[model samples]
Target: MGVDFSGPEARAALGVVAPFDMELDAELLRWLPDDVDMLMTRTPFVDDVVTVEFAREVADEGVVADGVRSVTAGRAEVVAYACTSGSFVRGRAGQESLLGVMRGAGAGEAVTTSGAIVEALQALGVRRVAVATPYVPTLSHLLDSFLGEYGVSVTGHDGLGLEQRIWEVPYAATAALIRSVDSSEAEAIVVSCTNLPTYDLIAPLEAELGKPIITANQATMWAALRRLGRRPTAPGQALADH
Candidate 1:
């Protein structure tokens, strides 16, 4: 006899439109409840280098609108543009434009990674945050500016200067980076990069560092799930816990 393929039913769904090189689909799913479904799509691939030009190209309104349209058929209640650098490289106006495009393309509710980071910070009542990223200084600075636009101060920051394959960076390296960027003034640590693997690091690092930790994938999933009127499950992660 064939195995029962329909053992469980999904209660709700969230849509995600990610960058071309995103490698964290499984990691994103780990944040969802068993009864919730995630519908994901990716923008066209670009060069391996992570740069301002690369961000601009990947964030083209036409491309993102198309991506959103492709996933809307899944009946997702909310759609998220899950690229931190791409969404913020153009600043707040550009970030808002992406939402408009996604909405124009059929997304009733939309969120971007950078936008979700801000919301996550606000939800946690955090104003001063430390940042660690796998980006060149130039790309990373854009994140600082993006946060500043919302009146959030960066207490400290450090970057690994990585251009590609961010997913391969081990937890030890990321943990060390987080430690290096942390400061007494910082209420939270922000790890910017949807491609970097951070689901397992949020809780332990929070315990050791004595602050909340918000990573790209965590914020994106949290915001999307929140919009769907459901809570994300990441056992000791501060963002999910809220």
Candidate 2:
């Protein structure tokens, strides 16, 4: 076979450490720029672990380290841990632990999805935000608490309380869920679950809410590309414009 150095395989790869069976490729395809590429590895999966119990149960340092080892195997310019709840479960220390593991495992640059969201909010100059999430109230509360520690206020929250098949949520329902949590006091709105889809709704929601709209996947993708020195460009979303 001729040495093929074309398409995504030849591009600067964005390594992703996804929660097992995360169904992420569809979401990544929507949020990431076509010129770049994603190389992914999966960690151990936990069934019905989208709740507070699950969050607490799965915040193991060993699991994070193992995931890092898997994803950083290739020549990725950057590696992103792409589980929002999992990243924030043990708070910032957990986030740092994940990043440290990635770097220790030889990632050129590393970021967690939760850290990416915080960076996204800061870059947009957003202080107060409304949130839409598919997690139960306890997990949703953790999301708020995590953002609060970063100086971002959670002015509103709408938790759908779903534990399974979050990725299958339709855009219409996700849009409506966002509208339910929106507040005039919010500088931005965040859709908090990586498994919950938001790529098609970002620009429209930003326009409707009259502020920036942030989602777990979009933020992580932005952070991975930005860390590798890529600037996202989109027509409406502030995160993209940066």
Candidate 3:
């Protein structure tokens, strides 16, 4: 679950399958309630390149089921596949298959960052979009194709070759990379990647870009809350109300 660290008074629970990176945990902690309990499992991956093999490895049913089962123990609510390109690379059908695994592991509701990004774009009524990410070239192209399948047009896109150093991508660089995109015909900007730190910049960037900004983490959190039958108050500019 993505909880804001600033709002310590409110607690929420979520089960997450993420890589062994503190950056993602740190970002989620910022918005998560202090008392929130998260059941987490680490998924191993080689950074930088987005490949079908990598996608398959992450979405391995046995691995995901084991992780989800460990976290949930017995209680069930919602579970999220926290990777953006990983899920998208697997394509829509692959994503649903992963969700099925999560449900099999005892998740009442299941979602992925890729699915959430699409849902967020649809919720905002955005059709044409420009996508940016701190991923390798292959992954970026895969994301473009994945979105196209959902009927979302990606006008332009770019990716950083930081490869496995994806976790090392700085927050400032992430914001700058997103800002550098020319979103002329795009209705919104999608900063894809939960591991990349883009949440804090969502509001300010939206004001400057004059369009909605959808980040992987933000969309995943919003989708999880919605699945739980709760509406999150807009903390950042992009999808504050909608």
RMSD value for candidate 3: 5.6
Tell me the TM-score of each prediction against the true structure.
0.95, 0.91, 0.86
The CA lDDT of each predicted structure is 0.92, 0.81, 0.75
Q: Any runs in candidate 1 off by more than 4 Å, and if so which?
A: 1-10
lDDT of candidate model 2 versus the reference: 0.81
Per-residue lDDT over 1-242 for candidate 3, one digit per residue giving the tens place of the 0 to 100 score: 87777753645577777654425776755544444455667775445244556655666777777777776774446877788866887788877788898898888888888998999999999989988987768767788888988999998887776555466777788888887774689889888877788766888888888899898888887787677655554576657577
Backbone clashes per model, in order? 0, 0, 11
Q: Which stretches of candidate 2 lie over 4 Å from their true place?
A: 1-10, 56-59, 233-235
Please give, for residues 1-242, the per-residue lDDT of candidate 2 as tens digits: 99877744556678887877587577776666777777887777677657776765454657766766666666675888888998888787777777787787777788888999999999899999998898888778888888988999988899888887888889999999899988789889988877888877889888777889899999998988898778654557778777
- Indicate the residue-level lDDT of 232 in model 1: 90
- Residue-wise C-alpha lDDT for candidate 1, range 1-242, written one tens digit per residue: 99999856646878999988888899999989887888899999786599888888999999999999898977775899999999999999999999999999999899999999999999999999999999999999899999999999999999999888889999999999999999899999999999999999999999998999999999999998888888898898878767
Say which prediction, candidate 1 or candidate 2, comes out ahead on lDDT.
1
Backbone clashes in model 2, listed as residue pairs: none
Instruction: Give the Cα error of residue 1 in candidate 1, in Å.
Output: 17
